[model samples]
Target: MHAATTVSLIPVLSDNYVFVLHGGGSGAAVVDPAVAEPVIAWLEERGLELEAILHTHHHNDHIGGTPGLLQRWPQAAVIASAADRERIPLQTQGVQGGDRLTLLGRHLRVVEVPGHTRHHIAYVLEPQAEEAAELFCGDTLFAGGCGRLFEGTPEQMLSSLQSLSALGTSTRVWCAHEYTEGNLRWAAEREPGNSAIAERLAAVQQQRREGQPTIPSSIGVELATNLFVRAQDAAALRQLRGHKDLWRG
Candidate 1:
């Protein structure tokens, strides 16, 4: 409804990507800036001021740019999960599950998706449109795979995935990475004959070959092909996580 608001994803160091979500220009809401230079340059180039920052987790790669960003726009609010207060102490406004906040005129509902980290959260942005929604899941959920359980149990991760899966199938998933090809490769190896795995692998491979990002995945796509989302239960999720962890390819 808001003229297809543009959310630019800027690839930072090696595998990290910081996203800038802004509506009709002038100001932006950044999500997980891994570094400051690129982000600062991007905003300055566009003559945009950072209005707020929504962090998905406390990973150094995720929050590393906060200090520098704040240096440019000191009044901008840093939003993060309340549970990780000590870890993400710089967050100006700590939030939790089921809470809603207004950003760029849209209502973002926080969904506690603890798997990569117990405090990891996904922001389901309810744009003022009739469509399903959009999610900024960070490392918890990826295009073809999910982040490893670093601080939470498989049961909690499975529950988190379940919660995410419950979102409308059309919701757009903005995961912070260009790892779709690698994850699909690993999945295709496990489910050798599976068409879903094969097709996704082919598509992602093509994207990589062309040097294009295979992100902004839809919930429907993940529901149909993401192996992690297909996990039956906690035990299965744990086993899958182990396999993925050791998966060299």
Candidate 2:
């Protein structure tokens, strides 16, 4: 059986999380380092060398630390969307949907999921033996919410979310932000009668109150609680997104 990959979460900024993926090797890769200091320190403390930086979009918070990380490990590969090369100029391995790459002896499939940004993508590392697959989804799909439409339409967002929702129920979803509590609260209010949303909101609130990270949410949990994922169509999704944008509580 293949060795399972190990993922570590490093929280940065106010709510963003930078995921470090290693496979019991000296070389490690990071997914969306919002800032460099924390990630660099984390890798160095473990005596691991940075090998690659995976970017899900061109957003500053997503790709902001690439230059800093690259400065420390000048040869580290910058993997990003080929279509967004102009915006993310640091990209060394510009890829798109349906592409596959190997990192730390593990295989990752690139899945283009544009909605929050025009060229946003996600990385899916399939399960090996007893390990569950992990999905490094940036701002596209949050724990209980989806990113607001910045450059794409509601239809595109819905399609992107639907594609992600189709993954294995046990797939671990590593979203970029810590918005679960707020998202679930909003979901509960949006669908006051939804027991799933209400129950999840309570649990997420408790997690936050205890200062615990409410991330790595599973596909099964999201499908059960995320209103946006449960949205039936583009029209329904559009309404939900609109309401979420104006929601303060």
Candidate 3:
């Protein structure tokens, strides 16, 4: 059996998270690094060396730190969407959906999830031994919300979300932002009678009060409490997205 891959969350910028993955070795890989100093520091503290950098889209926050990280480890492989080469010029191994790659002994499958950007993608680490599969979903799917329709339509976004929702229920979702509390609060407001949303909101709020992260939410949790995931169709998802975009609290 393959050694279990371990993931560490490095909170950066205002609400973004940079995920570092490794398999008990000095070699490590990071996903969607919004900034470099903290990530570099975190890895150095653990005596880890960056081996690869993965990008989900061309957003400044997602790729801004790549140059800095590359400066530290010039040989590190920079992986991103081939269609976005012009936008993400630093990528060394441009990939597309259905492609697979191995890193730190873990096999990762690329999933195209365009909505936040025209070529957004996600990485899913196949399950090994006792470890549940992990999903580094960038901004495509969140704990209680999904990315806005920045470069794609509602239908595309809905399709993208559904594809992610199809992952194994035990899969751990490591979204790139810390928007869980706010998303759940809005969900509760949208559905005032939903006990699932209400309960989840309360729990998330408490977690924030204690200065804790509500990330790495499971597919099961999102399937049960995320309004976007529960949306019946594209029309329903569009309506919910509009409401969420205008939500103030």
Clashes per candidate (backbone, < 3 Å)? 0, 0, 0
Q: Write the per-residue lDDT of candidate 2 for residues 1-249, one digit (tens) a residue.
A: 445679999999999999999877689999999899999999999999999999999999999999999999999999999999999999999999999999988899999998999999999997787788899999999999999899999999999998899997899999999999889888888889988888888888888989999999999998999889989999999999999999999
Between prediction 1 and prediction 2, the one with superior lDDT is 2
Question: Which residue runs does candidate 2 get wrong by more than 4 Å?
Answer: none
lDDT of 1 by residue, 1-249 (tens): 455557789988997889888778577999998899999999899999899999999999999999999999999999999989899988999999999998877789999998899899999988565655878999888998998899999998888888988997898889987788888888888889899889888888888788888878988999988889999988888998999899887
lDDT scores of the candidates, listed in order: 0.89, 0.93, 0.92
Off by over 4 Å in 3: none
Off by over 4 Å in 1: 1-3, 130-132
Q: List, residue by residue over 5-114, the lDDT tens digit for candidate 3.
A: 78989999899999999887789999999999999999999999999999999999899999999999999999999999999999999999999999998899999999
lDDT of 1 at 165: 85
Clashes of 1: 0
lDDT of 1 at 139: 89
The collision pairs in model 2 are: none
